[model samples]
Target: MNKFLFGLLLTSCSALGGNSQYVNPFIGTSNFGATHPGAQYPNALASVSPFNVAHGGEQNKFEKDAAWNSRVYIHENRYLTGFSHLNLSGVGCPDAGVLLLMPTTGPLELDAREYGSSYSNEQASPGYYSAQLNKYAVKAEVTSSLRTGLSRFTFPAGQSNVLLNLGLGLTNETGASLKWVSEQEVEGSRMLGTFCYHDEDVRPVFFVARFSKAPKTFGVWKKMPRYQNVEADWIGYNDSIKPYPGYRQLLSGDDIGAWLSFDTREQEAIEVKLGISFVSMENARENLDTEQPGFEFDKLRIEAQKAWDALLDRVEVEGSDEQKTLFYTALYHSLIHPNILQDANGDYPLMGQQGVGNSKQNRYTVYSLWDTHRNVHPLLSLLYPELQADMVRSAVAMAKESGWLPKWELYGMETQVMVGDPATAMIADSYLRGIRDFDVNAAYGAMVRAAEQREHNLLRPENPDYLTLGYVPVDDEGPYDGSVATSLEYYLADFNLAQLALALGKQEDHDKYLARALNYRTLFDADTGMLRPKNRKGEWLTPFDPELGRNFEPAPGYIEGNAWNYRFYVPHDTPGLIQLLGGPEAFLRQLDATFDTGNFDMGNEPDITYPFLYNYLEGQSWRTSRRVRELIAAHFGNHPGGLPGNDDTGTMSTWLAFSMLGIYPVSPGMMDYALFRPSFSKVKIHLSAEYYPGKQFVIENPVGDLDSDKPEAFTLNGRSIDKPFVTHEDIIKGGVLKVK
Candidate 1:
C-alpha cells in the first residue's frame, strides 16, 4: 500500500456521516469502566485491542499480573507490547484476551519487556484504531470484520518484524501450539479459560493468521519452564525463550511465540488478517477466506463502519454533542457481547460437551447473564427482537447440551461467576415482550428442572435449604455464602418463572413459584427494618452492619452490596415490602435516606433500580425524574472516564441507554416501565416490521432543557396518565410521548 491510496481511503471514510460518527470508543476505557477502544463490528466474534496491560505498574498504578485486571487496554498506560485479538469488553473477570501481535523494527527480541515500545497519537472510532509506536517509529492501525481482524503497519526503511506472543494475556491458563504453515501463513490453538480463576471451565480457540507478503525470514520460539529433567539439556532453553530460526514446523509448549521478519522500504505498509473460531482449525481458515478473500483493508473497515451505523441508527436522538456521544457509545458497548459464536460454515462448540454443533442462525456466546438479565436483554428484546430471539434459542441450546441454563456462559462453558438463575428471568422477559421465536416449551422445562433438581443442581446449590426452610439460611451448605442476597436473587428468579408458568397455563407451577417468590418475607426482620441474615435456627446473624459491604468490602450475608442496597430489591412485591416497612410514608423516608445519605451506589447493578423505585409511591414520581437526571449528569460524559464503573458486560450501559430514552424496564418479566424525562429533545426508536406492529416510537420533550433542574411530567400519546409507569404494549404501539 502507498500513501496516495491510504489518504484516499481516509478521506472516503471521513466523508460518511452516521450515528456511528458520534460514537467515542474511548469513553469507557478509564475509571475502571472495563471497556476497550477496540476495532470491532457490532456483535462481532473478533476484535483488535491495544495490549498495554503487560507493563504499566509504576506509571499507571495498574498491571495485569500485579492485580485482578479484566481489560487489555488502560487509558493511562503508555507502554504497548502488542495488539490482542478476540478480547472481552466491559467484563469484571478476565478471559479470552489472547493471540497478541506486535510489530517492531530492530534485532529479534523474544522478550516482551525488551521489545515493547511506548505509544502515542492514539485515535479510535467505531471500527478503527491507530497508534504510533515511538520505540519503533511504526504506525499501527487495525480494523475488523465479524470474525477476522486486519492490522496494517507502516514501517520505516529497515528490517521490520511482527511477533505473535501466545504466552501473555489476562487469562492465567497457558499452553499454546503454533505451526508455520508457509512463509505467509501461521496457524495455531491456545487454551483460553479458567475464567475468574475457576479451573474446570476451559476451551480452545483456533486461528489462522495470513500476511499480505511473504516475509524475509520466519520462525517459532518457545519459553521452556524450569525443570530438572534429563531432556532439559537436550531442549537447551530452560526458563528462557529458545528461538528456532527459519524453522517451518509445529511447536507446542507453555509459553511460545512466532515471528515474521521483512526488509521493507520507508513508509511501506504490510497487512495481516487473522480469522478465529472456537470450533476447529478448518473453520478458522474458512472464516478468514470467506470474510477477507483478499487483503482489502479499507473495504473491510468501511463494511464494519456501515454495520455499526445500521444498528446505531435504530434510535435517532436530538441532543447536545456530549449527550449524543454518551448515548451512542453506551449503546455501542451494550451490543459487543453475546456475540456470534458460529463459524462461516455454521459450526460451533457444543455447550459443556465434546462435540461440534450446527446452527444456520447465529449461535451466540459470552452471556454475562447475572449482569445482563437486569436490563441489557430487555433492551435487546425491545430494539433488536430478532437478535434477542436468537439469544433465547441459544440459551435453550445451552440448557439442552449442558443439562442447565447458563449463569455466566463464555465459549460454551459456564464459569458460575455470579449467583442467581438469571437465564429464567431473561427468557421470560423476552417471551413476555413477544420475542418468542425460540422453543419456549424446552426453555420452560429447563427452568423447571433447574428450580426443582436438588441433588446435582448447578444453578441453585442452596435449593434444598430454600425449599425446606423457606429461605437459604446463612449456615446452609453451599459453595459461597451471601445467603440473604442469594435468597433474594432466587426469589426474583422464582417470580419471573411464575410469570412464565402462568403465561404457559401451568397454574400449579405458577401458584407454587409465586408463593416461593414471596418467601423473602422470612428474611425480612421487622427489628432491623431490613432483610437481615438468618441462621438455620432462625436466628439473625449477630454483629451485623447494614453498610458492611460498601466499596466491595465483605459482608456477612451479601454479595457485592449491603443491607441498604438490598432493602428495596423486591421489585415484584414492592407493595408488600412497603407494607412490611410500615407504610408508604415510612418506605419513602427510608428510600430517600438511602439516596440522601449516599448509600445508593450507581456503579453496581444490585441497587441501580433504587432510583426508579420512587415511582411506586404516589405523588413522588417526580423524585424518579430528578434523581435519574442527577445520576446521569454526575456519572456519564463524553470522555474516557465517562462510564460509572465496570460495565458488567453492558449492564450499566443498558441502564444509561434506557434511562436517557425516558423509559426503563425496571423489573424484568414485567410489562410496565418507569417513565422519566428524556435526555434529548426527541428520540425516535425505529421499530422492526417483522417483530413490532408500529414502524417507530417517538419520545419528545418540547421544552428540551436538559440542564434545567425541573422534574418533567410525562403524557403518553396526548392523554395524561396519572401513574408514572407505562406498559410495554403502549410503548411499542408507536405514539409520541410528551415530557411536559
Candidate 2:
C-alpha cells in the first residue's frame, strides 16, 4: 500500500475502534528517551523490539559500544540486527535486551555485523511494530501476548535463513547456553545483569523460540575463543563462527547462535513465537503453549491491540490528532513496566534467593523504585488499584524473601541501582491512597527494619550517620554518598513511612519517623536557599555552588542533578520547606529562579514536582498551570524525540500523562492531587469498580479553555472547589470537574 492509502486506512481504523489507535509507540525512541517502538502488551513480561544498536552503519549516530546506549533500538539508527525478545523499555541502564531473531536471504551469516541490514517503512502502534528490510526486500512485523512475543517475516523467493543470535545483547554480562529442542524449536538461557555495571547481581533468563514450520536444515554455532599461543595455527575455527550443522544437543559459550535455513516461494511468511521466564526453561515453554497455542499472526495482533485498548481506555480524551497521539503514547509508556514476572503456573524466581516461588496473584518485576515511586505507582493506585495492590504484595513478598525492599529490582533480583529506600514510600503511598489489600503490618515491619538496621543495611548505608547526625554526612564514600540528595530521599521515604504508621495506629513509630523525616532541615542552608552538603561535625562544606551538579556532573552532595534542582524536593513537607526558604514569597522567587535560570530539569525526578509547588501558595496556582502547560509544549510532542529524556521506566511519561490530565500527585504518600487546566476539551477517567465507589471521573473544559494555560476557577460535580486541589477520596466518589 502507498503511504497515503496506509495513512487513510489507519485513520479509518482508528475512527472505528479504540484508544490504542491514538498511541504512537515511537514517540520516546530518540533523544536519549530510552524507549523503543517495540511490540509490547500492557505490563507484559515479553516484548519484541527491533535491535539496531549492535552494529553501526553510516546512518547510525550511536552504537551499543560507542556510548552509554541503554536501549535496543534508536529511532535514527537504520541498521537492523534482529528483533530481540524479553527487552526492557524506558530504562537508563542496559539489561535483558537479548535473544535476537533475524532473517536473511542467500547465505547464512552468523555474525550480526554481516547479517544486519538497513530498514525502512517503519510503522508502530501500541502492540505492534513493522518495517521493511531494504537489503533483502523482506518485511518484518511483531506483536505479543502477556508473556510471549510473536514475529512474522515475509521473504522473497530465495534461500532464506532465520538466525537466533544469543551472543549479541546490550547486557554487560556474558555467557549463554543454547540447545535445539526440536527441528522447529530452540531453547536457551542467557546470562543477564551487571545492571549499571554491577558484577555480582547476574541471573539467567530462559526462553523457548518456536517456529511455525520446521526448517529444511538447522545448526548451532559457537565462536571459539582465539588462542595466542602456538595452537593458534591448528585452530582454524578460533575467533571464527564454528557451525555444527544439524547438531541438536546443547552448547555453551560467550558467542554462539543457531540458524535455520529453508527455500521459500514468493513472499513466503514464517512466524516465530518466543516465551520467556526467569524461573526455568520448562516454564518458558509452558508459558508459550498457554498464551500462544497457534500461529495466527493477525489474530494475535488484534488481541494484543485489544489488550492495549483495554488499558488505554481507562483515560479517554477529546483533542487534536497530535495531542491525542502524544497523550496516549505517554499513557502507553507509563503502563509498560513493573510488568508481570510469574510464569503460566504462577511460578517465579524467588527474590534474591536460590529457589522458585509461587504467587496466587500476579508477581511483578522491574521495580525501578527510585523512579516509579514518585508517580507510576500512585497512577496505578488510582487507575488500576488491583494491579497496584498486587505490586504492593510483590514488594512485601520481596521483603519476605530477600530481607530488604527492592531499590531497583529486575527479574526478582536486587541491582540496588538507585539510592534511598523508595519501596517504603511506594507501599505507604499505595496504602494511603486506599490500596490496602496487602499485608500492611509486614510491609511496615520491613520499612522499620530497613530504617533502623544500621549494620549491613542494604537499602540504607547512610543510616548510621543519618541516625546520629540527622543527615547523611558528606564524608561517607560510596554510591549512597550523595549527602544532600540521599538525605532528601530518605526524608521523603521516612515521611511516607510515618504516614503509614499513623494510619496503622502506631503513634510511637509515626513520631519517630516523622522526626527523622524532618532531618532534611539539617542540610538546608539559609544562605544559599538550597540544601548544602554537611560533614559529621555539623559543618557545611566549603565553596558551595547550588548549580555545581548541573548536567549530571558530580557535586559534593548530589547525584544526577545539582542542589538547585533538589532545592524544592521536600514534597512531604512543602510548608516546612517554604518556611525554611523564608516564606511563600521567597519560595516562589527561588522556584521561579530555578526555571528562569535554566536550572529546572524536566527529565529528572528530583525537580519534577517544582511546577506543582505553585499550588502550595494561595492563589498562585495559575503559575502551576502555566508552567506545566509551557513545559509540556516545549518538551513533549508526537514524534520520536517527544520525551525530554529517559522515561526512567515511565516516570517522565507518567509526569506528562498526569500534567495533561490536569492533576499532579505532588507527593506519593499524600492523597491529594494539585489541579491545573487540562490540555484537552474533555477527559473521562474510568474508575476501577473493585476499588472505587463511582464508575468514572470526568474533567470537562466546555469553553475550549485549553488554549489558555490557567483556569479562573473549578467546580467538581457542579459544586465549587475553593482550592485547586482534590483528595483521593473526592476523586473516587467520582463526578465531573468543570473548568470555569
Strongest candidate by TM-score: 2
Q: Per-residue CA lDDT of candidate 1, range 262-285, in tens?
A: 999999999999999998888999
Q: Give the TM-score of candidate 2.
A: 0.97
Candidate 2: Cα lDDT at 659: 94
**Per-model RMSD to reference:** 3.7, 2.4
TM-score of each: 0.96, 0.97
Off by over 4 Å in 2: 1-16, 64-67, 228-238, 478-480, 709-711
Judged by whole-model lDDT over C-alpha atoms, candidate 2 comes out at: 0.87
Among all windows of 10 consecutive residues in model 1, the one with the lowest summed lDDT is 1-10
